[model samples]
Target: MNAFTRLRYRGSFMMRTLVSRSARLMRYCLLSLLGTLPLAVCAGEPVSPLLSPHQTIGTVNCASSTCHGSITPWEGSNVLQNEYTTWSRLDRHTRTYEVLNNAVSQRIVRNLGYKEPATEVKICLDCHAHNPTPARRGARFTQSEGIGCEGCHGPAADWIGEHAVKGITHSANIERGLYPTNQPIAQAKLCLSCHFGDESRFVTHRIMGAGHPRISFELKTFSALEPAHYRVDADYEQRKGSYDSVRLWAIGQALAARQQLDTLADPKRGHDGLMPELVLFDCYSCHHPMSDKRWTPRLGVGPGRMRLNDSNLLMLRAIVRAAYPDSSSAFDKAVRATHLAVSTGQTEGGAAPLQVVSKLSATIGAFLPRLEQQNFSPALQRKVLVALIDESAETSYADYAGAEQAYMAIVTVSNDLLSHGALKSTPALTDALARLLKTLRHDEQYDANVFRKQLSTLRSTVGVQERS
Candidate 1:
């Protein structure tokens, strides 16, 4: 099975049976002891861990034997106490900072004319490590730990002491300043801050030009790829509420679109010298070989015109079309207007005018809350899946980025449907998914015709009929 297929956690079945029984007994005992405790009242708005005012105690503080550092999943624990072990032993996040010391990063640093090694550079460290102001660093803090527990969970100084206490609720932990990682909106914002970029730490075209890989992200897929440390069992849902894979994917698309527009609207980040940041445009648009002849009239601009990276926008548009058809036309109009404005402004070889970018940004901003709040029902998920396929086939996935996003969307929605029993998993469906992924495996070799055909095959295999 591909990475898209869910894998069971590594352990023997007999051991798992014993562990489950023990866990149940322990959980019952704990509940009996704490049934009278009041739930924690949520306090202020969520804040990013990096910006939290509290000092960051080191990973060492979080990894003691009695804390989150158990060698295996602790029976009856609300969380996998072995989170520290899993992260250190298996999570790529643990290696993020270390990657800066490798040859590619060294070359990127050199290409950018920086004298400092990538590890020491502020820009590199911003996302690679849990970097904060010196005052926010506790005595135990060390940067070498890369993205540690506090990086995503917020500074541990305030909440670490009582978070695991017998009667403390999850919300109580949040009140004390634990970042709400379980909330989809909050998770999208936090993940995109580094995965896509935010006002503070963005990957500029300059950085990419210097050799950084183009950033690609889809929340649901990436979260699964993270091989999530915690299981979403009944206990987890009782505490954190339900987990909806499709809803996360939708919110991720909307927020990603909004974030891109917001970044483009920023005067400082949007322009580099006399040009709009090249990173804002699809990388493959200008990079592809002249011999490929992949250009199409789908974007409503003339051939050879630079195009904004609209993968997220395209995905979001499909979502709106499926879930809120009344808003679809308006959203489409805004996207077209932005593209036209960008084309017009870029004719002069500079950034799109701020007014133009800001208008579209606000339009997306207007649609955001609704998108976030809209429940992605099984029917809605299926409709969105069909809409995505229909749009991709009609438009022909003109850019590689959009095609990549489409593939992730298809997998995410399909998986959600399968989980809900709306679609059955089969060898044919599995093979179709793998083939679709293969078409996108190499951006340089991507053939739109092949991709469109694979999309059709997937649609048929999953029993979605072609539109009349």
Candidate 2:
């Protein structure tokens, strides 16, 4: 029941069984969850199985030689029988548990006052291993496989066999215990749980201080880096609904902003007796010395203001402007109000930060289905690309956070355009993006001057105008 303790995996896991419908199983072979399940599942809406805690049946359950494991791929089949092989060998997630033993995680644990081994600490295990509650853990569950099958996909006890039953719908699978990673909003929330942190596993400033990696996430970028196992083909669209990178990026930014603000608003999340979680505030804003801190005045705010971590907010604005131009100004006002509240440390006023967060959350949530319905074809993609680039123009992206977001945004938009045939395969485009990407490779070492220069070069490659 440890959820990750190493299991003596069956030797038969490599048999070349010519399995039928294995293609669907391969497609289903996704590492898939959420603290905001209630937020995701409305009363009448279909509930995600992950909303309810389910017992983990372990990765070994699906690794039968005849099931997900095989030496090579099954030909002419939809399922790749070597899924387990791929995860265990090629996937870096398999090493999540082992990472805790590293000097860095150990030092973090020491700083966190955990006398026990980092592997056993709840803080470390929550994200590293599939650390489900004991009551929901089956006999097969162990803590050694890291984020094995059920880590993303919900506990499989109820869905294992029933999922294979004929006529069982994808929704039926979700109802049983499969986490619906296919849905854009749902996947955004689920991925953010660890990547951005949720109620159970939040990346607090304390953790960052204790040497956790700076959290940077964008849905399309991260998903591709995972090198997704399944293809987003016609069959995938039929099952998962639809796939849109631009839409995913937009929803992801909105959700991340919402999540960060929600965490900021939570009185319980405040630590070290700080009234508001200073963790919720921007790190570079306070961490840097006075000599290094030159503030930019924007949104009618005066100079010398210590800005909040509003990278996500800025991205969301561009996203909204691209999809619903009319609402962009209103959204901007709300965001500014919230930022002002945080900057001035004023909770009471017409622009109460929490109220602003709620309003924006609802507004962003309302925009999801509308975005989902729209097609992000070549023309739309081009517009979005420009809108996104415009958000980072001139000194607007002077901050490291904004610059980093813009860098990834540029890469994703340009890459997506290339894939969709919206962008011409020209050396100007490729080299510009590559140079911009290199500037972002190291946040600590990033030279803002170099970034600005490269960003200018990147903008010159396109029709994006410099906003005076």
Candidate 3:
């Protein structure tokens, strides 16, 4: 039976008390526990950012062909002026809004009995375009820009002019309304808004059944894969501090874990008709072979009402153990509590799982700031990578989605080690990376044992355990 249909956490009084608490208070308490907020308001709905008055100054303000629209690189300034050109020419995000008009998207919405076209759907626009409330809109806030500057940068009506002023600190710009992409924590919150989803909008189980694509996100990989416009050179670093993909990757997992838990706890996002949102759980459980016998005992602790999609949490635990050994025992305690609450709640039968998840969310929030503070040096990164492998040494990588994430993570860490000159670029490592990627290509036929064996050989070649 679906966990949602089973006993739900019946701590309504406690839940109401939490809801009655100030958003700021809840935010702070969670921050105190985990030390990070994936969104400004971690609980409840979507992020309600503080932004400029009505009238987004507009993307046109920076769209002049000679300014940010230049086809060729402009060398006259420390910041390149061809951002618009790069976005228009190479960025898929620029065309996000148009995607809604596609036949598939239209059909999906139509099947859902939404009379409006996909382009007009609020759920679609929330992510596909830079749709903002009139109070937050400036004169130039155009849906045409499709997740324009203001979408990720906050409404620019208040900040655009001062942003151009020479020597204006990035923090000053942030104060004026620039979303602090320079801050990894802020960036994760911002990116995960669309990359993952929040209470205000999410890709629900119904949508998935309606043919919507499955969402996958990793901050560092996606940032690089974004064919990034901004260069992380000395000038950029001086302004934004150092660039650390490993740190971003680790934090992204933590933030993603928090996002999942938040969704699970939020009733609005957790249910659909009589079923709990199946999309929130491990897709492989239902989507895979009916008689595969792969799921003899779900989660290594017997069956439950729901098998959650805990890929991010798995990585977060391994990372916490690897990167912060001093906190590993404490961290494990918290992680185990969450794991047990979620995995065994319905099997054990209770309406208390969400409450448990809520408390742990706060614990994770407290850990995030400290997690961000640690240096994910190449050496440390190698440790975390190995820890991820060792911790997942069980049949954890058996699920297609989990295995795919593991593949990308392995590729990311291996590349990081290579870039930092920590791991020698040899044929063995190269072949191992290639083979791991190949398994991802054939998820239907993927062999977990082969993937694991290859990963172990990779460990030998990379020498991650020898030192870290």
Candidate 4:
């Protein structure tokens, strides 16, 4: 049997096990978590699911055998009925809450000066689990379940009953509070809230210093890595409309760049006491040993000057230059001005950083709509791939973070090309990609020169000519 068939058989076995063991508890836990809190909207944009006022009905509500808990895909069904099974058995998200009980979490809690366990700490639970206020939690809402179905699908209290009904349309379900995860912009916002953070919950420098891993995200790459529960087949397309992988990557880059600027412009979050938040700067810049000597001028800043982490910004510039060349120079100018302002703010400590952040934010904001509507043709995909490789060859992707993002972008673009038949998979291309992966295998051991050389090999293998 193939992988899908094997998974179906295993899921059948697991379903039997669940039915035999916890059928009673499963029924009880499906109680609704919905309350009277109305969905909040600012201007026209709906509030993020994280900030939504709806009650989060427990995962059990959607895990019944006839609902989304079948052992295999249901005939004539619009969604894969084994969503819960796939998530519980294969997805790492189900184990996020459990991670808090481990030794590393204990050490992190201690380092953060929290006497309570990581499970009990609000900061730790905020991102690790689908934790809402007590008032908003349904009777079956258990934090132990980690990021349950309702976490991403929005609090199910309002729509759970009607969602599975035969006549209820997808749009109608969305109107009742189901989050539009299929939309790239909406997906970016929801994922970035936890990955990069927002006004509500941010992974600050203090948390990183306390042993939390550094945050990194590339939407399309990460989504693929999730091994999505639902297939994008014809049925799914008819219900949710079509999507483009390249557009997902572009929108993700734009939003991530905007979020960074938003953080920098916030009066409360921008700085720590007299110093700017250390987390905003490139970690490798200051963390490297004195003897390493990895420094070279970046953003026109001289040696020994701190540099803001500009991985997303650099990726955004590549996207604009390839797909929207008219805006390339203007966007580059804004980025440079922001860097200079940040550098000057180091000494001046006035309004310079915030001022530049505003300008940069506006520049990126203007592109968001265009990116959402732009169709990334196969030719444009090649242009983007070439731009990413050319920029890496020129800049060497000096920062480890930039190199990491670059690798993800290259894979995303290359995969898109192959899927669309614009590029063929050959042994030379496979070896080139493998070499790039090896170069980026470890952040501490990363060598920019080696990475740059691999980019050149990849460019040549893909038949991208050197830019004159």
Tell me, by TM-score, which candidate is best. 4
Q: Where's the lowest-lDDT run of ten residues in candidate 3? A: 32-41
lDDT (CA) per prediction: 0.76, 0.66, 0.67, 0.77
Which candidate model has the greater lDDT, 3 or 4? 4
> After superposing candidate 2, which stretches have Cα over 4 Å from the reference?
1-51, 270-272, 300-304, 345-351, 445-449, 464-468
Best candidate according to lDDT: 4
| TM-scores, all models, native as reference | 0.86, 0.84, 0.83, 0.87
A best-first ranking of the candidates according to their TM-score comes to 4, 1, 2, 3
lDDT of 3 by residue, 1-468 (tens): 443222122122222322222222323322221111122222222233422343466678878876677777677576778888777777778889989989879888997889999988888888898777766665555787787666776766677777777888766766666666767777787888887887567888787667676677778666655546676666666655566667777788888889888888887887777677787787656654556666544344465345778778777777877877887877766665666777676423454878878876787788787766766777787787788777556556656567656655765665666666676657776677666665555444556777778778777766743555
lDDT tens readout by residue for model 4, 1-468: 553343344334433432222223222212211111111121245466666788887998888888878888888877889999888887778998999999879988998899999999988888888878888888988889989887788888989988877888767877777877777777888889888888888888887766676678889766765546877655665665566778888989999999998888888988889888888888777765578877766676778888889999889889999999988888887888788888655323455568778878888988887887787888999999989988875464888788878887887777777767677767887789778877765566568889999998998888842232
Give one digit per residue, the lDDT tens place, for model 2 in 102-129: 9879888888778998998887788888
lDDT of 1 by residue, 1-468 (tens): 321111111112222332333334333322321111111222445778878888899899989877889899999777889988888897778889999999889998999999999988989998899898899999999898789888999888888888878898877787777898877778888899899888789899888767776677888767765646777666876776656677778878888988888777777888899988888897767775578687778656768788899899899889889998998888787777778777655322354456667877777767666755666887888899989989865574877778878877887777666666677767887788778767765566667788998988988876742231
What lDDT does model 1 reach? Answer: 0.76
Please give the distance, in angstroms, between residue 462's alpha carbon in candidate 4 and its true position after superposition.
1.2
Q: Let me know the TM-score candidate 2 reaches against the reference structure.
A: 0.84
Clash count of each predicted structure: 0, 13, 18, 1
